[model samples]
Target: MAKFRKKPVVIEAVQYEFGMEDGFVVDGRYYDKSGPVPRAMNRIPAIKTLEGRHEISKGDWIITGIQGERYPCKPDIFAATYEAVE
Candidate 1:
């Protein structure tokens, strides 16, 4: 008998809401939208650490933390309102 292996899926981009708990909502979601806003808060900051364990720049591909997991998202699907972690 032979075993079958599944291929890895690829994502482009995703919309993310940065905040503590469930306060800031984006795309029908919520993040820590309450509290003192950071002085150096970047709505769409560059990716400092990710699955690659490296810095991510604009035009790069990424996914969203949905339901406590990273899901695949196409550039077009998320490009509309994709924000990096700050």
Candidate 2:
């Protein structure tokens, strides 16, 4: 079992790359191998994606769950749905 996250977290859009390739999802997201890079995640790698939890995938915004788990969120719905919290 995993711990539940209750508070809204700050998330940012990023460019996803599997290696020598580069491209879209515009929002100017990309991966820079020169420095601190984000870990790749998928539904298989995600600790959640069950029930009402957000789905994780490629070309999605990386959101930090309440308990500090990082997961992917769809771009369009991510913009239309959640508001940034202070």
Which lDDT values do the candidates have, in the order given? 0.39, 0.46
Task: List runs of model 2 lying over 4 Å from the truth.
Answer: 1-59
lDDT: worst 10-residue window of model 2: 20-29
Off by over 4 Å in 1: 1-3, 7-12, 15-53, 65-86
Instruction: List the candidates' TM-scores in order.
Output: 0.24, 0.34
Best by lDDT: 2
Count of clashes in candidate 1: 6
Candidate 2 lDDT score relative to the true structure: 0.46
Q: Candidate 1: lDDT over CA atoms?
A: 0.39
Please give the distance, in angstroms, between residue 24's alpha carbon in candidate 2 and its true position after superposition.
17
